[model samples]
Target: MFTGIVQERGEVVALDLAPDGADARVTVRGPLVTQDVQHGESIAVSGVCLTVVASHEDTFTADVMAETLLRTSAKEWAPGRAVNLERSVTPTTRLGGHVVQGHVDGIGTIVARVPHDGYDEFSISVGKDLARYIASKGAVAVDGISLTVIDVNDSPTGAVFTLGIIPETRTATTLGGAAVGSSVNIEVDVMAKYVERLLSFRDVEKA
Candidate 1:
């Protein structure tokens, strides 16, 4: 589990895709986050929970299975691509952001980026099926950074939400350099999904 607090911005140093395209080996340079990391430790890389296969002084390697690539924007990963990195939280860790499971629900695209007063407001489009779970003012994890939804606009085709990005957030996470049409891994509030599941059970009982 994580709190959606980005620890560092890491760069992909190497990406080795399998010849059969079944999996990939990714090595990232994250000095801060890799300082105390150990083999097999879980780390959130761009919102995807990946297990460390090998740990080094300033870099770590993880394998990305086909399923993960299919569900995330990781398929676009290449050397030099920057990514948000977070070490899994300990029991004493502060919940600076929100509960994040490091599970990417789906990939969303940045539709627009508006800069204002040294800050940025981004509008991202989510799939119609996943949009219902996102609510205005609610929390959503974009590329492992927790952000509040400023507004939600729903349409038959899709759902778009606006998020306010302060200077700190822009500099600390991958979202700061995110460009229009860029894909990001999104994880909606897990509590909302749990509540929906429980409500479905209640409806079944009522019937």
Candidate 2:
């Protein structure tokens, strides 16, 4: 489990694809997150849970399976690409942010970014299937950084949500450099899904 708190902004050192048509391996330089990381431990890279296959002084290698690449922006990762890094929560860790499972529910597109008062307001497009799980003022993880949803709008095309990014968040995480068309890993609050599932069961019991 992760708290969705970005501990550091890491750079993708390299991404190596296998010749056997298999998964790719990604090497990231994140001294902060790797300070005490061990092999096989989980790390949240841009909100995707990756296990460390190899550990080094200042970097670590993690294999990206085909399914993970297909479901996340990891396929677009290249050398020098900025990525948000977060270590898994420990027993004594503070829950600074909401509970995040490091599972990317779906990819979201950056629709617009409006600068206001040294901050940026981002509008992102999400899949309509995941729209019901999102709510105004709910916690959402974008590129591994936990953020509160400012508002949401549903349309025939898709669901669009707005987020208020502060100056600190803009500079401290990869979201600062994200462009309008960039894809980001998104994870909605798990509690919302649980509530919906329970409601469905209740309805069935009433029948």
Candidate 3:
């Protein structure tokens, strides 16, 4: 589990085939961070939790799945592409962000970036199927950074939402550099999905 708070920005040093089709070795650019990570420890890379496979002074390796790649923007990453990194929280750690399972619901693209009076607002568009799950002022995680939806709408292009980002966020994470048409990993609020599922069960029982 994670809190969707980005701790550091890492770069993709390498990504290549592993022994199995389900796994690949991802060498991250943040070597100082992963220098001491224990083998098998879980780390959230771009909102996807992956277990450590190997480590060194400047790089650590994680095994990634094809499903994860297909569901997120991680696959588009190249050797120099930056990624948001977050270490899994322990029992004693503070929950700065909301509970995130590192499970991406789908991918979203930045449709527009607008500068408001003070804050910057972003328009992120996703698939039509995910429209039902998104709600105005709801919680969503993009690239492992937790943010609230300022607005939601269905446009001729697709399902889109507006997000308000502060100056601090603009400097701390990779989102600061995000632009229109850029793909990002998205995780919808897990609680909302569960509530919807329970409501379906109630309907079945009533019938």
The clash count of every prediction, one per candidate, is: 0, 0, 1
What are the runs in model 1 whose C-alpha is more than 4 Å off?
Answer: none
Give all candidate RMSDs, comma-separated.
1.0, 1.4, 2.0
The lDDT of each candidate is: 0.94, 0.92, 0.85
* TM-scores of all predicted structures: 0.97, 0.94, 0.92
* Per-residue lDDT of candidate 2, residues 1-207 (tens digit): 999889999999999987864579999999998998899999999999999999899999999998888888998999999999999999999999999999898899999999998779999999887787779999999988899999999998679999999988888899989999999999989998899899999999999
Q: Least accurate stretch of 10 residues (summed lDDT) in model 2?
A: 15-24
Superposed by TM-score, candidate 2 places the C-alpha of residue 68 at a distance from the truth, in angstroms, of 0.6
Q: How close is candidate 3 to the true structure, as a TM-score?
A: 0.92
RMSD of 3: 2.0
Ranking by TM-score: 1, 2, 3
**Candidate 3: which pairs clash?**
31-58
The prediction achieving the highest TM-score against the true structure is 1
Question: Once model 3 is optimally superposed onto the true structure by TM-score, how far is the C-alpha of residue 8 displaced, in angstroms?
Answer: 0.4
Pairs with steric clashes in candidate 2: none
- Tens-digit lDDT track of model 1 for 1-207: 999999999999988999998889999999998988899999999999999999888999999999998999889999999999999999999999999999999999999999999789999999876898899999999999998999999999779999999999998998878899999999999999999999999999999
